[model samples]
Target: MFIFQAAAPGTSIIRRDLGAEPLPQTEALYAVALASPATLAAPPMGSLNLSEALIREVEAADVIVIGTPMHNLTIPSVLKAWIDQILRVGRTMKSTPSGKVGMLRDRPVYIGVASGGFFTGERANQPDFLTPYLSLALSSIGLKTQQFLTLQGPPHWIGARHR
Candidate 1:
């Protein structure tokens, strides 16, 4: 359920060089119930074939790499929708007294994030909501180890913009 963005030219964001299966960026719109009795009852699967396939990919992959653009200081709606599709009730995770516990095996998730403003490092001027939110979201599904590489201020942040 990765609402991924297209990778930069000559860059392989989805490949970890560990024979990781590469999943194409899912641009299709996805908005469905996060969890249901029918889906939760059996093996966690999406009501739609697309979501089901996405879930299976994530499950099988040894590592996950996501390339996305920060939209308005948060993830795009499409990404959120994709996330909703994968975070299943009984499949990817389960509700426990302590909290929602993850059922999937832990893995490393590398994310290449692009931003128009500085979210970290020196001369910071923006509130970074994307990192924390993504951390919690991915961790909920047992993808504990994560590394984020951000390209901030792109071509638009130079000279006067920096000053």
Candidate 2:
């Protein structure tokens, strides 16, 4: 929801709160679903123009950090919609005889995930499909370096003293 960009010690920190001004969900979904070689190659208009704007923001970033709350053991629908808007063929990736290759320069993608229940290791009660899926998704777009920061535990256990 909040994107924080770290800068030099004396430099000012840049912040963009995507949550403050959320994009229309219906518009995002339609843009992604209808995106194709022809649609992207055509004159930049309407939703395609919007997609271009989102792509520009992503392309301009040096480090991309995503803070997301886990919903139903995975990313929320709105976040998925945002991902769909940015991950465009020929822009983020391209097809070739070998396969699809990422066009964006490789960068660090830090994911901050907050979950209600245990979602890691042997004590985990819930299945974690978010981490792997996100990793692959980002890698496919050339953001290979990734780091995850997770805070997991039920609300009831937050202030309980250990025996």
Candidate 3:
């Protein structure tokens, strides 16, 4: 499954130029499940429509790829909304005596985050909220493997690469 966040200006190029695919929501989930046959079913999450379906996608996927662009030194609103949909109480995560226990496990998450400025400690930019927040959020659901590829500035970080 792929989470594409291109709400930021100039990032629409990810689709036209980079040839990326976006994840489907709601009833589309039914189509994919029917086409590919899976043991996934929507869980109880109040009146939310996509929450259960999105969780199933994450759980079924062996690897998750997220494409996002930093906005205002953080993740965009669309991505945040998607996160809210996926992260549900007693479903993706649960409260325990130790703390909150993540339900889903044994999956790798790959995040592609593009930014206009460098985010490493030595860079002029401040600490990146995108990576840390995503780490915590996804970790809460036991999907912990993550890789971030950030492209900074118009020239596109020609000098250095994030490792």
Candidate 4:
């Protein structure tokens, strides 16, 4: 399991700016045999100069975990930046006549999201651009198996919970 941490908890600007309580300094991950038959390795992936380590981690992780806060009804810029690093053209995927095809092996992605407003279920009141966008983005890399865990309520509910 790899905690694809876009921002270290200690320096997570979103959490700080949102006034959320400090995240746990030490986090642990356990992995189960999350597998798929996706083993198509045709388009060789290029390792981004700076993101090579991140790409390696993604390849190694059987289960990937990302914890993020939805900002402005979508993902924070930090998370977006991280995604840009991993979404390599020749590396993670390749362009085909039909469309883009992913070359990396598939894995389970679990996303934990914190939102200031309710966007789904009966209490839905706001437009939800987060989940759909993430679903599309992640699926592009062959990470089709995904689950979202959301915690929504009043603004700063995340902070209050930790405190």
Give the top-scoring candidate (lDDT): 2
Clash number for each model: 0, 0, 0, 2
lDDT of 2 by residue, 1-163 (tens): 2223233443333344556766556465456546666666663356566667877877887777888878898887767767776676778877678876788898888898888887886558989888888877787778888999887776776663111
Residue 23 in candidate 4 has what lDDT? 21
Which segments of model 4 are wrong by more than 4 Å?
1-47, 155-163
- Candidate 4: tens digits of C-alpha lDDT, residues 1-163: 2223443433221222212443222111100111112322221233224355667878877677778888999988767766766676566877679777887898988888887778887777789899999988888888989999888877656554321
Encode model 1's per-residue lDDT on 38-146: one tens digit a residue: 4444533444565576678788777688777788998866677667667766768888899988888998898887888888877678898998998888999888999
**lDDT ranking, high to low:** 2, 1, 4, 3
Reference-based lDDT, residue 9, model 3: 38
The CA lDDT at 36 in model 3 is 24
> Model 3 RMSD to the real structure?
10.3
Q: Which ten residues in a row have the lowest lDDT in candidate 3?
A: 10-19
- For model 2, state the Cα shift of residue 84 in Å: 0.7
Per-residue lDDT of candidate 3, residues 51-148 (tens digit)? 67667767766656777788888887667766766776566877678876788885776777777777874664667777888888888878777777
Write down the TM-score of every candidate. Answer: 0.70, 0.79, 0.66, 0.65
Query: All models: lDDT?
Result: 0.69, 0.72, 0.64, 0.65
Consecutive 10-residue window with the lowest summed lDDT within model 1: 10-19
- How far does residue 15 in candidate 1 sit from its true spot (Å)? 8.9
